[model samples]
Target chain A: MKIGIIGGGAVGLLFAGYLGQKFDVTLIVRRELQLQSLLMNGITVHKGGSSFTTRVDSDLLTEVSMKFDFVIVAVKEYDLKPLEKVLELMDKNQPLLFLQNGIGHLEWVESLPHHNLLAGSVEHGALKENDHVLHHLGVGKTNLALIKGEWGAVEELVSQSIPSFPFLLKQDFEEMLLTKLFVNVLINPLTALTRVRNGKLVENPHLHQLQRDLFQELLLLYPHMERNVSFEGVVEICNNTYENRSSMLKDIESERKTEIESILGVLLEKAQREHHFVPIMNVVYRLVKGIEREGLGG
Target chain B: MKIGIIGGGAVGLLFAGYLGQKFDVTLIVRRELQLQSLLMNGITVHKGGSSFTTRVDSDLLTEVSMKFDFVIVAVKEYDLKPLEKVLELMDKNQPLLFLQNGIGHLEWVESLPHHNLLAGSVEHGALKENDHVLHHLGVGKTNLALIKGEWGAVEELVSQSIPSFPFLLKQDFEEMLLTKLFVNVLINPLTALTRVRNGKLVENPHLHQLQRDLFQELLLLYPHMERNVSFEGVVEICNNTYENRSSMLKDIESERKTEIESILGVLLEKAQREHHFVPIMNVVYRLVKGIEREGLGG
Candidate 1:
């Protein structure tokens, strides 16, 4: 099976390397430097204290006049808007998995067929450069689900001969999504706003309570969040990736629009739906919104 | 009735000058220049576009041997503890009014009769040196409360006055104290930790959001609060005093231990009462407690 990965950066390249272990993978990168480097020297991945190079089909979307079995969108929140052309280029029957931080954004995939609608959750970090060198910093895990019906191929892929980033099936994907939403709301926007690393969240006085408050309050919105995700698990993840900068932090550093709205922003909306109160999150919303409006994000 | 004011700083001198407007007031100010200048040239008070001078008792605390009806402790919070010997000069029956921010600690006042527990909440800005200058910038209204009730001459003295500098009996004193408590929790530690000004809170993304989140969470803690002070009233005070530097800002500027403990440190204390559940205050409490241990106050 030929899988077309749309995002050129870390996640895209990592997935390409993973799936390329068996399947023929082609990566769609944007920049000329990446396309040139990957096409010339294949793609090099630095993971597990070693470096491996694999020659995958590396080309720009304009260079490709073909279809694939699946197309994964791994771009940043705002960058996904430009991926419309990639989706249009996908085979009508091919599945599309969106790997993102927050949820309530299925409308963007509305143009695609319902049978092909697949949502996935990824918990990992990877760094990439224009040279197509990928640095797998921490854990790698992906849980995919068919949003509508029982798609057997997805589960078969989950039990594949080669695992793509330790891929697995998420039972009742919405709950996992909600669990992720809670974590991101507590982690991403916070680190992004505070400019602190994941582990350092425990150290910062201005933020630690906020994390605790955010998690406690979001639990009111998603009552089963704690039941699914343990605090030790979250804190361990935070500490293990302490040195790694969160995507939101990088976005703020690069002067990009924050996914705060999609993350904590949507939580407040869900609070209204769940008849739960999120006073702290509302404060977080007003603040990040003000920061966004101050136009500080370039 | 003889009244002595310690700490020739702005607040002290202002208290001396304002009280001198009616009854006998002697400001126990230090330094030859401050004393000579205040007694020589007098205090220049700029109020409502009109400037005036007042000649009052401007001398050192050591020189004050006579018993006074009232003693106003107008020193800075840091200087308050060291002034224990000076506060000892007070007459046993003398009511001591404290006109400073943060809590007026009572370890020293423990010996005094309960009626001697005097707390004053004033909104006044005064800058003084060789120039005895007190600028009642916008308003100088003071709210004083007797936590320990003893009929004093100053109460009648203030009430019978021309209603100038509007002094009111803070009916429910604890609310006023909590109003100031919220200020400490919301403004002081935040500005101290961030090392920014009131206006800057609206600018910096991370610092700004932390303030709002912590502030709103505090208000959400209103039910948990022993006092239900008006948030709007505090905001108005903050807006009015936006340009005015707070005690915490001043402490940070001078490099001192923020009274974050005196303000929010108590939140960690196990509930003494059955009706207490200060979950929101715990956020500020833990943050400050951590910073305190890390010795960042220096």
Candidate 2:
């Protein structure tokens, strides 16, 4: 099987490195520098106390022409607009999987003409060190759900799971995405705003109170989230990734754009549509956006 | 007239520098280092292109034993608890004026045994560079209101105003403090939380929206605040202090204790008492406190 990972980010490199060991993989990136470096060094993933180098075919996103059995979209949600044209030109029959963080891309992905569209909730924590190097901080599985068409591609990926990185099939796409969204909504912005490690959300009483208030505000929008995601489960995730800086925090610290629009932005819009008063969510959303503006030379 | 000023902070040094020129002044400080520095070199005031040094007697807060016609309490709101005992031992006839921010100190000042009590709202933007050096950033006046007892002392100080350091008397103490409180509540926490300068509160639309939401929440507690403080006035203050960092922002950056409790904490108590919903205020309050803990070696 041939796999095409459509980003050189942490998740993209992780997938390309592990999957390349088992199948023919191509790592596609937008930057010429990253593409040149990837062509020279391939992908190196450091997990636990061991490290391995995987030799994978690499190409620039605009220059890539070869077809793949399965293509995984690993770019951020904010970066998806430019790829729309690229995705449109792809083989309509090819199976495409989106591995973005938030459900902000669901509508866009559903609009694509691909026959088999998969939405994934990635639980692993991966950090990109440089162009072709990544740290696989957390070893976890990817939960995939069929957004449309046949589920054969997702099932095949699930059956061919690697040792540490497993793939599980989820029954409902919205529930699967919301489960991860719940954790992201609670953890990401708070860590980013406070510039603290993940565990501080639960460790600090004041932050914990703020987190609960935010959780309550989110529950007003998705009343069924309580059944899908427990409050304690969110706390457990913070404890599990105690020392790790969240992706949003990392982005803010590095002066990179964050997924605030995808995570909190989506919720703010939903609240407005439903006439739900999510003031805390609104405050957090605007704060993160304001900070992003400040970080980006505003 | 002999005037004893308590606190060696920006406001304290500012008062000592200007008022020391006309009256016999004694600058009181809690730290021996600041006292020694002030004793060695008088208070230095740098305003625009000119600089002036005013020599004044210095004494530690614990060692001060001299009598004064009036005393100015220039400490932060959170630092007032430790001074309660010292205040009780003062001469009953000596009028005490508090130059603290927020209305949190009003009730506590009322409980003092002094014959005359005055509360002041400092409009000047002063930054302390060292133990005895201060940059007089903004040349605004100090608004003084009589909290209790006779108005003779306040009248004397108002009549003997120093050049460029004017003193205006306000009829209502609550109204005077609330006006400053309104600006502090809106500008301080937002600037500190976002780590932006005062100007960004108005420059950044997202933060401006958050500020407006917070202003609306505050109105629920004090319906008459609209008359005392205009939303336009708050924006104008941000514009006037465009390049200045708020004191609370500086406090957080220095890892020093913040006055969040005195400012937002008091308002939170009032909201609870009246059953008002100030979700944004609550979130901002908790986030600042949480960040304070993180900064203070939590």
DockQ of 2: 0.84
Model 1 C-alpha lDDT versus the unseen true structure: 0.68
Give the per-residue lDDT of model 1 (tens digit) for B1-298. 7777888877877777777877688888657677877887766777767977777876766677747787787876657777777665556667888776655464445555435667777766655533577676646577788767574866775766646667777775567766666766766665554444555554566656666656665564455563465555555665666776666656545554666656765533423243455544554454444444345531
Tell me how far the alpha carbon of residue B97 in candidate 2 is from the true structure, in angstroms, after superposition: 0.5
Estimate the overall C-alpha local distance difference test score of candidate 2.
0.91
RMSD of 2: 1.2
| Best candidate according to TM-score | 2
Give model 1's docking category: incorrect
Taking the tens digit of each residue's C-alpha lDDT, what string does model 2 give over A116-165?
Answer: 89999999999999999999997878999989998765577778879788
- What lDDT does candidate 2 reach at residue A82? 93
Instruction: After superposing candidate 2 on the true structure, give the runs of residues whose Cα lies further than 4 Å from its correct spot.
Output: none
How accurately is candidate 1 docked according to DockQ? 0.11
